[model samples]
Every structure is written in C-alpha cells, then in structure tokens.
Target: MRPSGLRHHHRLETRAVTRFEPNLRIPGPTSLPPSVREAGGRQMINHRGPEFAAMLGRIQTGMRPYFGTQSEIAVLSCAGTGGLEAAVVNVLSPGDRVLGVSIGAFGDRFAKIAEVYGAAVDRVSAEWGHAARPDEVRERLRGGDYRAVLLTHNETSTGVMNPIPDLAAAIHQESPETLILVDSVSALGAVPFEMDGWGTDVVVTGSQKAWMAAPGLAMVAASERAWAAMEIAQMPRFYLDLRRHRESARSGETPWTPAIAVIYQVDEGLRLMAAEGAENVFARHEACAAATRAGLEGLGFELFADAANRSTTVTAAWIPDGVDWKAFNGEVKRRGVVLAGGQGKLAGKVFRVGHLGSVTVDEILGAIATLETVSVTAGRPVEVGAAVAAAQRAAIEAGIARVPVAAGA
Candidate 1:
C-alpha cells in the first residue's frame, strides 16, 4: 500500500467551464437570447413528424417579414454558402454568362462559385473597403450580354454595405432580362432588404448572422421571375434543389432531415425578433454601428471603409502605428474578448469589430476598454477615455442608453 502522505497528495485539477457570454462584438452567431437557447434544448422531434411540419411552417411564416417577400422561403440544412450555391445552380445553366461584383472576399467567393458551376463569370472588381457604385455595376451590365448579376448586400470582410435599391434599378434599366441574385447573409434583419419591392430575383441569408441563432441553416427567398428562370435552366442539382425545397415547404416539410435543434433555436430567435419589430431591430443595428464607429474614431483609429458605405453589421479599423496588432489581439483574448482578423489581402493591416445582432452598449464599452488598455500597453498612443465617452454619447443620442450622459461627462 502507498504511504498515507502520498495518498493525500493526489492533485485534483479543476477546469473552468467557459460560460456562454452573449457575442456582442461580431456580426454572426451573435448572442442567443436565453429563450432561444432554452428552445434549442427541447427534445428533438422526427424530421417527418407532424410537429416538425408545424415548426417548419411557423418558421417560414416568421421569415416572411424579414425578407420582405411574398415568395416561398426555402430552408436548407446548410450555411449561407449553401444558399449561394443554390441560387447559382437553380437559376442558371452551364456556360451561361454571369456578371459578379467583387468588393471583398464574399464577393470573390460568389464569382468562384459561379465559375465552379461552369458559368462564364465576368468579375467586376472594385477596391476593397468600398462599395461598387450602381453606376459601375450598370456599366458592366450594359457592356455585356449576361444571364444574371450577382452582388453582396453587405461585404462583411471590408465592412461595406452596397446600395441595393439603386443598383437594382440600374440593372433593370440596362439589362432587364438579367436576373439579380443578392447575398444578404450579413444584411438581412440588420438592414432593410425588400426583395420583392426592390425587384431582386433571389436573396439568400443564414440563421447565424442577423437571425441570432446557431449556424448550419440557410434561408432563401426566390421571386416568381427567378422561379420561372429555374424552370428552363439546365444546371445540375440534387440536395440543394430549390424546386424540391419549394415543393416540400408548401406542404410544410423538407426534402431531407432538418437540423432540428438549430431550427428550434431559429424559430425562437425569429419570434423574438418579430415581436421586437423588424424596423426596431434594423434601427438597433444602425445605432450600434454608429456608436462603434464613433467610439473607434474617438480612439484615433482610422476606419477602412468609406463613411457612406459603412456596414451596419461590422467595422474594419486600421491598426495604428507603433502598436503590435498580434500582441493587442492576444491581450484582448486574455481579457475574454474576441475580435475578427482581416481576411484576404487585408490580413495584419486591419481588424474587424462586429456590432450586429444582440449586441449592447455595455458590451461595446467593455470591448473599447479592452482596446484602449491593449493599445496603450503596446505603446500605441491613444486617448484612453475618448472612445468610451464617444460611444456613451452615441448611445444616448440613439436612445439606447437608459440614462442620459453628456459626451465627455
């Protein structure tokens, strides 16, 4: 037998369980409401069961107001990219001419997806951190005979929000037959997206972003014109078949097994969002974005995107001189705050701050405080109190702050 002292010396290692804090800093997979999380924990139902059908029908009905469309909502057991693929495959045939506007990584992905589907993709490249103007898109559409035009309503990577209404009007004016497919993954709910009123043929979004639910599900709404185009298109598709989804959804079911847990969460999240009112949700995003920008400016960090085109979901800030971005990011992480790094060609030069679904003024303030501490500690000269104060001022002006406070008070 071992000695008595040795027996008492056994170390008990206790690991700290990471608590689920609301994600108030980024655009997607934002903080889920407690009610949504509770719903996600509900007992799973059979995919083909009546309960599932009822849930699916209720979700489709809930999505209508967010999309601002009377078109059928196709729920797919995939991410936003799946919805993008569905849009490409369902409405266009192989060797069809398509024009894709590329302002950031997501836009580039759209062009790549089109190419993979055997479309003759013409990329209209624009400078990163800026929106491609309607006139520019118009020029490209007028210059070629294309079957469709692809655009992103919000380029999350560069924090640029495109002017969709004006762009749609321009496309219709120049090439009325060219179908319009928009990736509203980051813009839906956070911004006003009127698919029917704007004449967009197809709009795709995911549950994670503005929906404030877990990932793994995508939603698409296709106009009658887009459905008509799908009827004659020769593109090959099976699991992502919009036609099948449309048919099944009409019957209040899905062609395949749905992510029951995620659907439960999505249903609850959408219910909460609808109850708060879509316009109010959009306004919250706008105010949060403005506050974030004002806070960053107050800290003396330069914004990467133009003011007019700034995304309501995220903001890209250039790394100031003398600050070690890596170290600063590490410090923020150590403080239990996570921020997104720049993607593509912007890596290391900038960082993204998300202000989308479920974010609050206090969370934004906490992040700003962390930023201020890290920047100052890393030898980057920043006005410590300025950013937080500016954010507080913005919160008050937007009526988000319950108690009024002066800008510098």
Candidate 2:
C-alpha cells in the first residue's frame, strides 16, 4: 500500500495536485531561473562591505544596455511603484503643470502618483485595449508649458505596449524643454527601450519582471536634464529620494540598507542575460508572446489588447462565455499552471498570461495543454491538443527553435 502522506483527502478532492511541479504564469514575481534561485540562497554578505560594493557596481553598469542609456542608475530597495514615486518627487515641484498619458491600470497609477505628489496633472487617455497615439499626445502638448510628462512603457494591466519612441519624439517636438519620465517596470528587459536615442529623461524598472529575479529592488536612470531639475524641484522626499540614492551609489553603497538577497539574484540574472545577448532576449520574449496569443486564440478566446499594441511580456484574453472566471481559474491552478487575473475594471472578465523572464516555449506549451484540459473538463468545447499545436507552430515561426521529437521504432 502507498504511504498515507501520498494519498489525497476526499475533502480536498478538487484541489490541484501541484505540490512539486507548480508553474508560475503571473505578470510578476515571476518564476526564477534555477541559477538565479541558487544565487539568492548564497549566504548573506555584508551590505556595507567591499563584496556588496562590487555587486552593486556590476548591477548598475550591467543594466545600462537594458535601459539604452549612459546615464547613472540608482538601485533602490523598493518595489516598482516606489520607483514611480521617486521619479515624480525628484523631478517636479508642487503645482507644476504636467501631462500624463494613460492607456491602462499601470498608466493610471503613474499619473496618480504625480497627482499625489502635488503636480497639476493633465491626463490624456486612450481606450483600455489600445495604445496612446503620438498625434494625440502631440496635440495635448501643443501650446502647453508643462514641466514634465509621465509615460508608461508597457501597461501590464491591459497588455498594451505604448509607442514610446514615437511618443517621446512628439513630446520633444512640441515642448522640447519638458522632461519625459517613463515607468518601464514591465518593458525594459523583455522589450527594447532606447532611453538616450529616444530623448527620454528618466526611466524605471523592477527586478521581478524581465530580470528573472525575485522582487525587492527598483532600478532608475535619469538624464542630465532630469538631474538639473532634481536640484531645484521639491516634493518632500527622504527614503524615496533619487538624489540620496545616486550619491550613495557613487560610493558603491545605498543610503539605506539594500535588499542583499534580491540583489544577488538580479546580479546573477543579469549575468545570464548578458551571456544570452540582449537582442536574443528580446526575440525570445517576442516568440513567447506569439505563442501565448496563438494558444489563447486557438482555444476560442478573444484577445483583449489591440492588435498592433500588444505587450510582449504579458497577454490578456477575454474569459470565455459561460465559464465562471473563479471556477475556471481554480481548475487551472489545480492543474499546476498559475495565471494572473484581470486587474481593476477588467477584473473577472479577463485572464492574463505572463511569458517573460526565462520562460521557454516548452513551458508555455505545457501551460497551453493544461488550459485545454481545464476547458474541456469545465464542459467547454475545445479541440483536443489544438492550442498546443498552434502555440508550437507559432513559436517556431517567431524564431524560437522548433521542438524536438522522440525517435520512433
């Protein structure tokens, strides 16, 4: 007889038997790579010691290519939201006129941060599933003497990727002096962002998303113009102050104690990324996005984001009709594939699949297969293995290596 511990209780019959093989498919606090997870477990080091200093130096310098900037970056021991707050308070003063472009939930949060910091914010919004048009942003900037413009590179909530290069150009053409601050927490490593070439003044990202690490650190980079503005702009900052972080970074230290473990994970993640090469990293994300979208569509689910503006890191699809979101999600969870729910106004109507940071086509295929099984189990009509086949083909066409087959007798 099998051991009692291996047997399932009747009371928990419906629970997913995913004790050892759970797959994380959420937007962030993503599944870490094996090497990165190992790095996180190395014995803790002195935060003020030379070893910490060297690690700090490597992280800041290593992250430049991802941001596409030569500007100095400050690594703060906070979440991505904290990075947004730092961007707001460090660059604009109370009552300063600002323009905020919002396309989804994260966009709204970036704008809201500006408002809470006392900036007189004027919002330019797009439909939830669409990208903000450059012409619309230009029209808003016309004849307005704004101190700064807040932008989101990728709105994780609605699965939209804003055209930052085009939008930045429009802002500069209309108001050259206006500083451009971007929240790229979900875009930097997974997608390409050219900070210096695009004339962006400030950009921020977190460790959890594309960096393939656990969450805890936010990396921020600012241009010379932003630094000039920081010297005078005051919105009352201490712990979230970019100036203090930057100063401490010059000495390979943080003003406050850093999240040493997460930093270790990020450093190792960066090394892996560097080895893989940046362009390849972007291509892998593109392939994963293609696979996820194809799989969801093959299963008769409609995608939520507009066609041309879809995000490469996360894909949002409308929950199928007649299926209860909670029940469906629970079944999927039980099968070992954990997905993200719709956020804000989209709550209960959509499901998001995150495919960034060390996620592979094979893993995505497994998730697609799981979704197929769950859908069929819920009385939904799904063509058996159709979604998985579609995903495999899509991944191959998008430049990922084709899956290998076993030798037959």
RMSD of each: 6.6, 4.4
Per-residue lDDT over 1-409 for candidate 2, one digit per residue giving the tens place of the 0 to 100 score: 8766557564356566656857889889888877888888999888888999999999989999889999999999999999999999999999999999999999889999999989999999999999999999999999898999999999999999999999999999999999999999988998888899999998999999999889999999999999999999979999988889888888889999889999999999888887777888888888889999999998888999999999999999998778888888888888899999999999998999998888878889889998998888888889999999999899989999332110000
TM-score of 1: 0.91
After superposition, candidate 2 runs with Cα above 4 Å error: 1-17, 401-409
- TM-score of candidate 2 on Cα atoms, chains taken together: 0.94
Worst 10 residues of 2 by lDDT: 400-409
Best by lDDT: 2
Whole-structure CA lDDT of model 1: 0.84
Superpose all Cα atoms of candidate 1 onto the true structure and report the RMSD in Å to 1 decimal. 6.6
lDDT of 1 by residue, 1-409 (tens): 9987666565321221243552357667676767777888999888887888988988888888778898899999999999999999999999999999988999999989999989999989889988988888888887689999999999999999999899899999999999999999988877887889999999999988888788989899999999999899988999999999988877778999888899998888777776677767776776777788888888888999988899989999998777777877877776667888888999888899988766666778778877776677777668778888898788668767321111111
Which residue pairs collide in model 2, if any?
16-334
Off by over 4 Å in 1: 1-24, 399-409
Best model per TM-score: 2
